[model samples]
Target: MKHLRFLNKYFYKYKWWIIPGIFFVVISNFFGVIPAQVIGHAFNLITENIQIYRLFNGFERATVIYDIFSYSLFYFGMLVLILYLLRGLFLFFMRQTIILMSRHIEFDMKNEIYAHYQKLSLGFYRRNNTGDLMNRATEDVNRVRMYVGPAIMYTINTAVLFILVIYAMFSVNVTLALWCLLPLPVLVLIIYFVNTLINQKSEQIQEQLSKLSSFVQERFSGIRVIKSYVREDYTKEIFAAESQGYKDNAMGLVKVQALFYPTMLLLVGLSTILTVYIGGIQVIDGAITPGNIAEFIVYVNQLTFPVTMLGWVTTLIQRASASQKRINEFLQLKPDITSKNTESARLKGNIKFEHVNFTYPDTGIQALRDVSFEIGQGQFIAIIGRTGSGKSTLANLIMRMYDIDSGNITVDGNPLKGLNLNNYRNQIGFVPQEVFLFSDTIKNNIAFGLDQVTDEEVSTAAKNAAVYHNIVDFEHKFETMLGERGITLSGGQKQRVSIARALIKEPALLVFDDCLSAVDTRTEEEILRNLSKIMKDKTSILIAHRISTIKNADKIIVLDQGKIIEQGNHEQLLQQNGAYAEMYQNQLLEEENQSL
Candidate 1:
């Protein structure tokens, strides 16, 4: 129960529903209990051992209304009839109330979790799977709903049944009641031990289940690649191992639950046998009437059923506890990058990195070391470096993907730490190396968060990306549905669509991290020409390997081994005959040889 504190706010928000649910549960239990007691009275009357005139408490002496048989039959039948109808109606209400509360809370919690994921920085995603996080939002929340819903109903039903049954037994005869309760201590001890086992085993089962889900999702998403590489058997081996682990864990829980019902029956059987034997002696001695014994036995059986349900409820609660802990751990995690300030929209694209050093957390190798650079507003700059030379790391730093180990990054002459992170991010646009699109129409993907953008604006952005003509050629044009990750589109088309997405934002700072790598040289040249014209006044950072891509840039920074070895315009670096000069010469010679 203490593990459920993470849901405190959600519970408070929906107490209106929860309160009504509790009321319905209590009322429903009342209807449920009354029928059981009435049944006991009916049994005594069927044997002609108790008089119908004394139905309530045997307090009346005058029998004027009806004969014993007729009166007992009608009164007892009406009691059962009313109880059954009312019980069904109340149960219907209870089901509606609990479902409403559960679904409402589930909706709110899933929304909250999704909103929190949005608030988290990119570094959080680097260490987690998209599918697993999605499970927490979808499956785990529903599991929690089940726990809150039926757990509440059964908990109330269990408590109410125990109290009502105990009261009914004592009312019949105190000595018989005492004997009926004698097995309670042993039953409780067995239940406690069984519940402990169920809790422990159920937790392991849920963990293994999550692992199985993650394995299947990942493998299916990459199934084509596995087939291409001919790793089918290898993948199957891994999947089978994961699936078997889930089976073993689940079976362990089954074994624990299997023992629970039998132990419960044994306790109930012992109590029943003792009740019949002791009450038989009391009847023979004329200490108590046989009708009383019959009534007491029926109430005892009613009590045992709810107690049996606890075994299953115990299993669910324990499984729920395990799931809650995983979800709570995720919710409680602090992002790698966070801003403490409250100001909004303060960034102006003036970025400065001063003697910054960084190393990946898991691997101790420095990704960027003592790197220093600055860019003024509206300046178009290019970053050029060989593979593994930390070119991408600089682009990542602008978005604060990984924090620097030392020194500072300032935007618009103010430290980035003092600006609201979300506000700052909204002012920047990025086109990543890998192009990804959702399984939605092209129009929604382009307009994304710009609610007020017209179709004209989307068309203009797409035209600038050099993909508008290609899209218009499709049967659906801009309304065409793209497959997941834009699998339906060609490689160059996907890259251009991603570029169009970034262009649509019209951000003050636009960073292209290898955006033109997929297209041929001719297409790349045309796209860069268009981008250069449109972004003349906007601050832009282009990360590329082709010298032709960044030759006309206002500034070019060359990096090698996590340090900037050269910085200049294209002509200035060409004259130096240094690192940039060698790269330019090799590309020029390669093209010249191809033409020959």
Candidate 2:
């Protein structure tokens, strides 16, 4: 239960309901004892040939035996009715309280977990499986909910039933009651073994289930590639293997569960037989009244039933423990980045990189080594590099996705580490290579960062990105639902929308990391032309694969193996006849051949 301590704060909030819930359980327990005593008394009246009317207190002697029998039946019926009513009250309050508690915990846990994910450094996400993380937050939280709700209710039921039934039995006949309890130690030992087995099996079952879920999510998200290569059968085979593994593990769990119930029933039955056998001889010897034997039987059933359920409760608790372990592991991970900005500072457009060095979190290989650069306000700079040549790393450094190992990055000479990240990011706009658009109207996607923007402003940004006409062609125009990931839009259209989103921010600095790679040359040129028009007085960093995309930039930086090898305008680099010259010559030759 210590694993659940993190939830205590939420649980404590509803103390009012919990307190009443406990009271109801106590009242229910007291009422539950009544039925057993009445049943025992009725049995004694029937067996000892006593007047049943007199056997029930407050009932006068009756001439007709039918009247006496009816009175006895009435007494028994009332006892059962009251007990059942209290039981219902108990269940209702218990269910309501547990559900409220679980709901509170689940809601807060998800919020905290997601907030933590948002604060984590990009390197952390790069090393972890996103699908599994989602499982931990959603499915794993649900598992915790189950434990808090049903598991708690059953635990309380078992404990209350055990104590009350034991007291009732001892009050009626201590000797037979002790005889009935003789199998308890053996039953406990069996339960311990069962709990251990169940825990082990449940862990395996959950692991396989997670693997299956991750496999399914990955394949479904990449279904286009699977269909493109006509590898449907191969994909199916792989999915079948994963699915069969989950099935086998689940079946094993069923087998364990199958044995759990019957074994519990057998032990309870054995305890019952022992009580009846020992109590009968005492009755025949006239050592105890027959009513005592009947009450003893009722008490015995109450005791055995709860003890049997104890086994089932133990199983659920073990499974819950397994779930808690997974959830706790995720919660315990310390984020690589910290938001310790006790004093907020506004950002300036001037950016600087001073001998910055960085390495991938998982691999020690340096991604950026002693690289230094500076960009003042209103400069249009382009970064060109071969694959894995640290172009993206430089952009990431500015975003503070990964902290530098040495030196510093600053905005207007203010160290990034000292400034509030949220405040700093608000002054910059970032557009990534892979465009992500939510399922919403085009207007909403464009104005996502800003709370409110005029319709004129939205149209202006879309027009500048060269996507305004395309949006207007839609039947709903700005109101059209984009569908998931903007699936309803074309790839080039998605790229343009993303560009428009960045443009609308109207930030002091805009970073486009290969944002226009999808569009045709003409569209790309037009978008860039529009960007220059709007961002004439803002710092801009453009990363691109095509030389033509950045030919007219104020300056270009060529990176190779985490170091800048050249920096100049396209004309100067062309005349220098170095790495940049070679790249340009290759592009020029390819275009010339295409024209031919």
Candidate 3:
């Protein structure tokens, strides 16, 4: 119940619909209870006429029969029909308003979750599994809708029906009503005890389902690896184990329901038996007529269904509560990275990293230590480093992916924190080491960064990246559709397409983070030559492992073990004969040996 408090705002927003919905439900139940009294009166008319017929001759007996048919039969039939018609009408409106409101609320909640996901930082996604997040977005949202729809409606239905049925029974005979309701307190005790167990089992079931979804997602995404490793049987066994756990948890919930429903029915049966016995004795003692006893039995029967439904409604509430708690956990998260300042300024790419130090969260390992560098506008700078030398970390900081532990980064003399984040990012075009292309047409992929782009712009960017020739050779050319992550394309083609995506943006700052690794040396050189013309007035940062890639740059920086060891032009570094010279010599020797 505490977990449901978050939904209060939605209820208030739709209060007009909800209020009328509740009124219709009450009216339907009011009409539903009247049928019992009408049927009881019909029985009384038949019983009295039969007695009168027995005391009369044939003509008089025929007249009593005719009277019964004319008065009791027609009146009772018409009243029952009218009551049922009104009940149906109200029930229709109840569903139209309340159930429709629930669907709208579901739509709004899902969008809210999606918007929150967009605001979350990259680090949060790295820590969470894709399948788990998806389950919280989809399945958990649906369960909350059940709470707003059927659970609420049925709860009101049960309450209104109970009150009206009890009032009707008390009107007939008070003592018999009290006796028939003896099982209610016991029913309440059962619900209280069983509800606790249901809540626990329901939570366990949802947790297991999330685990199963994650397991399946991982297996499908890595199916190629499993086949190459010849671990099909091993992976299958693991999946079976996860599936079995999910089944066991589901069965546990089913077991609780199995016990709960029967116990409810048993209580209802006890109340019915009590009504029949007590009302029969009262009629036999001449304290009440047969019609009174009949009506009492009808009222007790009406009470039976609502009482029986109590167990089911309790289960729904418990399950919905468990799901709400899971969903609220995600909604409550505050993003680690956000733009605190609203000031906007255009960047000229005069970037400076001042004594920057950063340690990744939860690992305590310093990814960058006192790293400092400066890049002026329209400079061609290259960074060469061994693996884990914080090359990518440097680029990530520039993109504001993570905040530095200590020190400041500035763009165009303005502090990075003071400038608006989106405006700052829009000025830079970045191609990461790992290229990710969406499942869309090649034209769309090239123009992904801009909201409005022409086909001519896409074509020019592709040609500049040295991929247009290959694309034109295909049957569909620019309209060719790509698979997930561009799986259908070669690695080199994907890298070129990624480069084209960034090029089309025409950003003030361009970064290529080992983006040309898959392309051959000749193709890489051709692409870089084409970029030189376009990058004449734009600042460019190129991160590469091969010495040949960066040897022609205006300036090169060499890093090892998260610290800068050397900085010079291509010829100056060779003259110094230091770490950069050693890497250049090693690469030359490897190339000479491969030629042999």
Candidate 4:
């Protein structure tokens, strides 16, 4: 219930529906209970007229008595029928308001979770799995909806029906009504005990379901790897084991629920038997008439269904409580990364890192330490480093995916943190080492960053990235759809397509972080030539391992570990005989040897 308080705002938002829904519930039950009174009256009418029929038998006046009997029966019959019809109408209205409100709340909640998922920092994603995130938004939300809809509806329906029916019974004969309700308090106590077990088991089942979904998601995504390694059987065994655990937990709850229903049937049947026995005694004593006994029986039976629904409603509530707790866990989180400024700025791309320092939050590894660099507008700078030498970290910092621990990063002489995060990110074109593309057409993938783009612009960007020839060769050309992560394209083709995605933006600061590792050196050279012309007035930063790729950079920086070991133009680094010169000589010798 504490966790469920989070849903109060949604309830208030849809209050018109809820308010009217409750009204319909009360009205429906009010009409539903009146049928019992009508039945009692019809019984009394027949009982009272029996003497008149006996005295007027076999005579013409007896025809008048018969007409009276016929009209009385017809009147009572029609009244009961009309009452039931009215009850049915209000029942329909009750569902329309309450059930429909639940769907709207569900829509709002899913959108909320998805939007928050996007706003969270990278560390949050690293700490959570996709399946768990998806489960909380979908499955957990569904359970919560049940509580908002059917559970609440039934609970209120039962309560209203109980109240109307019980009051009618007591108004006629209090002592008989009291005896018939003996099992109700006992039913309440039993449901209280059963609800606890339901809550505990429900949480376990949801948790296991999340694990199962995650296992399936990962296995499907890596199915190619599994086939290549021939580990399909092993994965199947693990899946079977997980499925067994889920089934066992589900059966546990089902067993408890299974025992619950029969027990409810027995208790409800006891009330009916008590009404027949005790009311029979009352009628024999002349304390009430036989019609009164018949009415008592009807009242007990009317209360039957609501009493039976008690266990079910409580079970749903317990499960929903468990699920809402899970949902509230994620909803309560505040993202660590937020923009200090909200104003958009046109960037000139003069970026400076003043002794920047950063450590990965998930891991204690410091990716950058005391690193400093500057890139003026229209400068082409290249960072060369061994693997894990803080090159990618520099790119990440420039993109502001994570903030620095100490020191500051400035763009166009303004603090990076002082710019609107979304506005700042929208201006930069960043191509990471591991490229990701959507399962969409080639043209759409190229134009993904923009809301609207011309097909001609897409083609021009592809031509600049050196992937236009490959695309044209396809039967569908730009309209050809890609598989997940662009798996349909070859490695180099995928890299080039990724480059086109960034190139189409024509951004102020364009970064290529080892994004050209798949293409041949000839293609790389051709693309680099195109970049020189297109990015003449923009700030460009290229992080690569190949010496040939960065040799023509305006300024070259070489990194080892987390520090810059050498900095200068190609000639200056070669003359110094430092790490860069060694890498250049080794590459040159390797190329010469390969020619042999």
Candidate 5:
């Protein structure tokens, strides 16, 4: 309930619809009660005139009495029919208002959640799974919507109808009303207890269903692996066991729900019997007429559903409250990384790292220590290292994905944290080792980040990345649609496409983190040759293991065990005979052997 208080602003924001819907609910219920009153009056008219009809019997204007009585009943029935029609119309308006408002709120909530997700830092995503995040946005929000829409609607409808019917009952015959309503409170109490049991069983069933779905999804996603391992029988048996569990849970729920309707009917039937018995006594004593008894029966019947719904309405609110609590957990989370400045700052890519130190927060592994370097504007700097030697960590720091634990990183003489985050990132073109492409056309993927791009620009970027021929070979050329994660292309093709995507931006700084690993040396050299023409005045950082890739870099930095080991040009490092020279010699020998 405390967490659900967050929705108060939304309720107030959409109060126009809610207020009108409430009005319509009351108006509809008002019309709804009139039908029972009219039905009672009709009964009275028929009961009173039956004797008069008999008095004129035996062919002495008896036919005239019959005609008058028949017309009177028809008129009263038509009034009841008109009253229900009017009730139905208002009910429709009520749904249009309140239900529609709930939908609007749902839409806004999903967008707000997704926008917040974008604002959260990478650490938050690492701390949570995708499924849980999606459930908070979709499943939980849906439950809250039920509270705002149907639960509220039924609650209001029941309360209003109860008040009107009870008032009418007391006004007619207090004694009969008292007897008729005796079973009602008992009915509510029993239903509440039984309904709680049913809800527990239902939640168990839902849990089993989720497990089944997860099992099936995993099996499908890893079908190839299972088949390769020849574990089809093993997985099949596991699935069968889960299915059995689901059936057992469902059966338990069905059994509990079986008690729901019968209990309601029994209690309602008791109330009805009490109404007739007590009203008969009143009639014999001349305290009330048979019409009064009929009216009491109608009122009891009218109240049967709303009284029964109290338990279900409470259940919905309880579920919604729980769900809203989960939603609030994410909404209240402030990101670890926040931009200190909003204004877009111009940068020329003079990056300096002074005694920077960082550790992976989630894993508690120190990835960089005492890393110091300076890249002047328009410098082609390369970083070479063994696997897990902090090469990518340096790139991540430069991208500002995470802040350092100590020391300062300044870009263009401005503190990295103090500069506009978006402005800084927008000017840099970064191609990660693991490439990801959207399930869209090649042209769109290449031109993804820019709002407006011409076909020529996309083609030029493709050519510069040495993947132009691949595009022209496709059936739809640039318009060819790819499968998930660009699975339709080979690894080298995907990497090249990602390069094209980054190059399309023509950013001030380009960071390629082992992006050309999949391509052959010839293609890699061709790509470097083409890029050199465009990178004449822009800063570039190349992180790679291959010496052939970075031998021509203006300056090279060698890292080992999370610390800088060497820094020099290729010739100077070869003269120094350090780790860089050893890697260069090994690669040169491998290339010579391949040629032989």
Candidate 6:
């Protein structure tokens, strides 16, 4: 119920449709209940006339009874036909308006979740699993749609029909009506008790489903590792365990429902029996006519179905409530990163990091500590470091992937925080260590960032990255569709394609975070030579572990333990005989040994 309040805006948005849909529901119930009264009246009219006919002559009585019977049947049949027809029409409109509106709201909700995900920072993704997020966006959203659609429709139908039928019963005989409603308070109490259990069970079922989804998603993504390790049977066992957990939770919910629905029906049955007893006594005393008993029975039957349906409606509400709580938790999250100032400006190549320090969230390990550096416009700078030396973290900061703990990063003398995030990011080209390509055409993958790009531009970028020959050798050239995560390409080929993706942007600042790790030294050199020509008038930051890769840069910075240890060219570092020189000698020896 609390979760439903989050949807008030959507209800308001579609009120034009929803309000009319509710009207149709009410009118449909009116038609549906009216038939019971008609049947009762037809019986009453026949019974009353039969008593009258007994007093007349044989021929007169026979003709009068026949005429009354025929007219009564004809009138009852016509009323039923008209009422049912109207009921069907309104039911159709109700579904068209309300049910369809729920579908539209579901679409809007999914898109909104995706849009919010885009705004969230990298830290959020690190904390949440892909499958769990996907479940919230898909399965949880569907459950909420049920709440807005069938659940709401049935609830309104049951409520309105209950009111009408109770009014009808009261009109017939107040005492009989009160007797029939005696079990109602007990029924309400039962519903209230079962509701708590249903909500708890539903929440458990949804959580288990999320866990199962996450397990399956992780297994599929790491299938290669599972196969390589020959752990298929072991993985199957793990999956079975997860599946059984979900099944057990679902069964628990089913058991609660099994108890809930039957109890409601039993209570409704008791009410009917009570109605028959009280109404029979009234008829025997001649205080009310037989027609009153007949109408009361008809109205009681009408109430029975809806009262039973109340249990099902409650089930829908509880399930949807559980799912809505999950979705609301995500929707309410505010991203730590926000573009507060909208003053947009194009970036220049100069970048300065002043007293920057950052620690990874959740784990208080310092990834960077008072790190400071400056790159002049169009300067080619290189960063070399051991693993976990904060090299990649530095590049991430320049990209503003994470806000610094204490520092100011400026581009062209303007603070990074003050600039429009999108405008600032648009000017930078980044090729991360782990390259990711969409399941799209080679050309589309390379031109992914651009709104409109010419084929010639794509070809030129591919050629610059030294992947043009590989593309041409493929059956479809640039139009070749890649497999998931570019699995169709070799490691080096994927790296080169990623490089081409960034190169096509022709950004003012280009950061290659160990992007050439997969390519051989000879091929890496060739690519670097090509990049040097393109980056002559652009700022380039190359982060890598290989000394040979950054030996020829205008400036080289060596980091150790999140702090800069050495800063100089390759020859200058060798002259100093520091950590960089030691690493270079060690790598050179490893290459020589491998050759032997």
Best candidate (score: TM-score): 6
Please report, as a residue range, the 10-residue window in candidate 5 with the lowest summed lDDT: 201-210
Q: lDDT (CA) for every model shown?
A: 0.81, 0.81, 0.88, 0.91, 0.87, 0.89
Best by lDDT: 4
Tens-digit lDDT track of model 6 for 1-596: 99889888889999998999999999999998888888877777888777777756476567877787788789898998999999999999999999999998899889998999888889999898888999999999999999899888888888888888888888878899899888889989999999998999889888888988998899888888999999999989998999998898888888988987788788778877886788789989876777777777777777777777788889889999999999988889988787877776777788988989999885788998888888999888999999999999999888989899998898899888777889888888899988999999999999998999999999999999999999999999999999988988999999999999999999989999999999999889989999999988899999998888999888899988999889988899999999999999999999999999
Q: Which ranges in model 5 have alpha carbons more than 4 Å from their true place?
A: 187-258, 592-596
lDDT of 2 by residue, 1-596 (tens): 67767666766876776676666666677777788887777776665445554565454444566566667778777878877788777767777776677687778888988988887777777777767778778877787777776677667766777788888777767888888888788787887787778888877777777777788788887888999999999989998998898798778878877887787778778777877798889888877777777777777777766776677677777777777787778678887766678665655578888998999878887988888888888999999989889988888888887789998888878888777878777778888877999989999999987888998989999999999999999999998898878989999999999988988988888898988888999999789889888888888999998999999988899999999899889999988989999999899999999999
Candidate 4 is scored at a TM of 0.96
Worst 10 residues of 6 by lDDT: 52-61
After superposing candidate 6, which stretches have Cα over 4 Å from the reference?
49-61
lDDT value, candidate 4, whole model: 0.91
Instruction: Show the colliding residue pairs in model 4.
Output: none
**Cα lDDT tens digits for candidate 1, 1-596:** 77777777777877887777777767776776677667766766665534444463444443442456677778888988888788788778877877777788888888888888987777677778776787778767777877877876787768866876787677767888888888889878887787778777767776776777788888887878999999999999998998899888888889888888888877777778878888889889997766666666767677778778887777777777777877887889777777787778645678899999988775577888899999988888999999988988898888877778899999988887777877777878888777788899888888775768899999999998889999999999999999877888999999998889888988888999988988888888888888888777788999999999999888999999999999999999999889999999999999999999
TM-score of every prediction relative to native: 0.93, 0.94, 0.96, 0.96, 0.93, 0.97
Model 6, total clashes: 0
Supply the TM-score for candidate 1: 0.93
- How would you encode candidate 3's per-residue C-alpha lDDT over 1-596 as one tens digit per residue? 99989999999999998999999999999999999889888878878877777766477567867776677789898999999899999999999999999998999999999999988887878788889889989998999998899889889999999899888888878888898899989989989999999999889988988988888888887887999999999989998999999899888889988988898888888887888899889889887778877787777777777777788889889999999999899899998778977666766888888988888775677888887888888888899989999888788888888888998899888878677898888878899998999999999999999999998999999999999999999899999999878987999999999999999998889999999899999999999998899888789999999988888888788888778788878999999999999999999999999999
Of 2 and 5, the candidate ahead on TM-score is 2
Model 3 reaches what TM-score against the true structure?
0.96
Q: After superposition, how far is residue 543 of candidate 1 from its true place, in Å?
A: 0.2
Instruction: Tell how far residue 131 is off in model 5, in angstroms.
Output: 2.4
